[model samples]
Target: MQHLDLDFVRQQFPMFQTELGQKIGFLDNAGGSYVAGAVIDRLTDFYTNYKVQPYGANPISNRAGEAMELGRRTMAELLNVSADLITLGASSTQCFNTLSIACTPLVAKGRSAAAGEVIVSEQDHESNIGGWERLCQQQGATLKIWPVDPESGELALEDLEKLLSNKTAIVAVTHSSNIIGTINPINEIAALVHGVNAKLVVDGVSYAPHAWPNLDVLDADAYVFSTYKTYGTHLGVMVVREDFLQELAPQCHFFNMPYPNKRLDSAGPDHAAIAALAGIGDYFAALHDHHFAGKKGLPLHRKARAVAALMNQHENELCAYLLENLNDLPVRIFGRKTIEQREANIALSSPKISSKALADGLAEYDIAAKNGHFYAYRLLQAMGVADMNDGVLRISLSHYNSLEEVERCVAGLRAMLG
Candidate 1:
């Protein structure tokens, strides 16, 4: 495998050429990533040329409709799912909430004395946990939490098996923790959930930026991620298996129930944003061609996987360096302190200084690190961190980050700790 061409990769993102991007080491990518130039250009083109109501019987309208469909088709191709199965929404939170509402009516039926069970992971963001909890409460279903190991910040599969029973109707979890950064085994979990005839919904917002997961291989009932976090527009992309889509009640109007794409979205689609998301596919194809020359004719998903492999290798190197330095400093690092078990997100609490103080100090060195519970408030509270207000300092990285940037971040942390 060829090593990532950092220069070629950095050129795709216009942010790196900006004065602020040049001066600051952006380690707060988990909050959101800088958009690629392709996405920006596409958004501009849509508004300039095709800003009409799509699917109408006119020239500009037809072009607008084609652009919107192209985005959906490209995203579906990248995820290895059918185009009709994918829905572009406002955000991942909205998507999950809509899904929960649609599922409540269906799953509430045939309940036993124990009530139907929905298993959620404590490590998930509020988007994944809260919606299901609300559904369970409203429908008189039991909500079970799959707890993570307080010391290691790991979710054990054995514990998940214990929670599984015949009453389980749904299991919601994250593909990777936004705080801990540990990559969960979705395929295994999907199989386990399927064995009990329960639906599995995966939150892929954090993981999707690092890797474009093959939904066919994962076989999840539903999967969701944010395009803005993956170098695209500010919209959420969700894929539901056809059978699963049929199982849920329509959240949209009665007339739209026949249309799979419109069944879940309550409002009109973001036409410009949906059209711009095709840029993600454009960026991925560009990266693949640049790294592996003449490897053309491959499917979009295969190209995405190829680009992902290159990104993962580069990111792991950066993660390894940060882990070594933080471990040497003896900071209380959360999650697995190894590259093989986690993504590039690392959260650490300093015994000598408050997390907020450390984050504030790092800013002086032009390192944009963040300190907070990061919406995984329950995870922090469960880990016995007394200062949830201060939380831990999180250093999140993406493929655009370089070794030199990692060294600079480490140097900043070292100086602050010293």
Candidate 2:
């Protein structure tokens, strides 16, 4: 298809057919996206048929093991990376925590030549920052802040350069800000971090939903994202580069050290959630088939890339429309006023009404949105937001969201602001 077929795209998600779902315009997609029908089917099938302990002697166990392996492989395939590099956990926060523990030798005081330093961006979600902070505290290592432009809430490459030194062991940041919606230049950041012999860890939770992570090109030592935000089950995927993996202290059981994928997987999340991830691959394949021609021979990751292009294009249009309308309103948009270098996600505050009040008004109109610092508390605090609790109203979007939904959001905001 020349453009994303919105009707066909919306149908893949079962939520749009429900009573409340039909009534409400779902703009709070950054929190979590509605599960695709394929994902639901796989999840239900797993629970009903083979919910036994996997990789055991029994046939059911073998089948369960195969299903779980397929799920893991699907994630690796989507990212175009080796399956052994992918580690699944409860959530991205858990993954990052495990990764930090794994890096104890690199960050700890006597273990390294000097008390190692770590840099975390001020614009990052707490999931990416807090784990490293706690790790540094325990290890007596220095934790440097890569400050954001207080007015724009955007991180500067120059600030990160100043923070990077030979003492820097790790530089953790987000692929995109949940509140500001700005997409950081990961490649450039990676180059700078690598130049100083520091490893890069990117939290891709917000960016993955809008644009699938191209791990093939992203030069980070580690990358993490949540499946729940990508229209699948709740699971965090962490992909560690082989060289980087060897540098970290083993995070798993002694016997499990041989297994590359299990090295950083401390939290063995639900088996069904792992099995259900194959459905995300299924969902993307279906979209690719519907939109493009003769991609059957192509690999899953390449097909996903093609499908993501369509999704990104459609979302950019919706975002542009939303920004244009909101520009005339009495609201202060936190990030770039245009769609450039941003996702469809948006955050704003209005002088006429509190963010909480604006959110409440939108709820009356059946438009889904919420107001909070959204775990980007440091960024909002730097931006001079008075109340972190009532930070800003975030209207996050997904591929299934339509122009009509954005219009409803704008109209609701107009009513409340006026």
Candidate 3:
């Protein structure tokens, strides 16, 4: 029965203190979230004090190296996974691309015993689909689509069943659709994918912002999410299961190849960004302490899950309120009309007004919603949207978002639709 303290939550983000941030109702969180003040502090500290090459015999270099390692270890702790299993990259797209290339050894001609097959979902963003498609083509492997219901934009579990076979080597899908907002059954999908002896690679970019990832129970061979979307610095965090990682060819330099964590890191990301990740852990710990009185001693991931429950509850209430109010409007909601089986993210378009026009109108109200394909072009196309460029108007919420913000958005939509 512990409700999230919105005031306390908003205080943690420095953006809310600014004039422009206070004026705008930011509903574009699906693209990226505001960085926490703690994260900013960490980034600043790293640049100010230890802005040199890491791990050298010099004292300053050692401090820099230690800071980056702490950041890496903290992220692993946040996900309840081993540090060696996590890979940090500039973006999830880059992580997936590196992974796809690393997978070449599994699918390339004369690389493996069979011509491998890779299955991608129509419900996923291009970040999860395109790389695998190109890999399949390059390797002379078959590529299969797990189609969504054209009308509903829901991917059927039965359709996925048909795609699994002995030839399948990889199945790439989203943990939740960035545009559709529906949370896919990744655990069930993992079970099915593993039955065919194929590795499951999940893009958790959309899901992690709403719910901090728990890799301990999830059976996915690799799970990827963007830290920038999770109130941290801009970076992609990919956790590869030890066994699956051992099978892929290393993407790093020969000297770094021996390190399992560095194997998928094709290009080293910003040092300060990596160090800033420690702040995300700090932010979560602060939230957990504020909400839960006596469980301060719980592990980092446990604390994160506790905090995530409150966040999900607050976001779902706002989402349901927005959906109910929009019921009278002419806009066509793309995913579940209710909050059931969906994140706070919602996408809709209307024949009465163009998506761009609606977005522009909301801007008049100082609302920060957007209209576009949002990189889920295939999903929008499958759902029969006419203008892929304009796509659907998206209202993606974060924990820091308030009911007042939701009201402002609903009011904007009502005035525009009417």
Clash pairs (backbone) in predicted model 2: none
The per-residue C-alpha lDDT of model 3 at residue 67 equals 93
Candidate 3 — which pairs collide?
Answer: none
Off by over 4 Å in 1: 109-114
lDDT of 3 by residue, 72-190 (tens): 99999999989999999999999999999999877756336578889999999899899998998787778899999998899988999998888888999999989878998889998
- Candidate 3: what lDDT? 0.93
lDDT of each: 0.88, 0.92, 0.93
Which should have the higher TM-score, number 1 or number 2? Answer: 2
Q: Which residue runs does candidate 3 get wrong by more than 4 Å?
A: 110-113
Residue 238 of model 3 has an lDDT of 96
Q: Model 1, 1-418: lDDT tens per residue? A: 5899999999999999999988888999888998988888999999999898999889999999999988888888888777888877898888998899888755574346646789999889889999888898788788999998988877889999999998898999999988889999998998899999899999999998887787778878999999888988888888888999998888888998889988887665689999888898899999998887789788888999999999988998999999988888858999877887789998999888999998998898888999999889888888878988899999999999988888988998888786
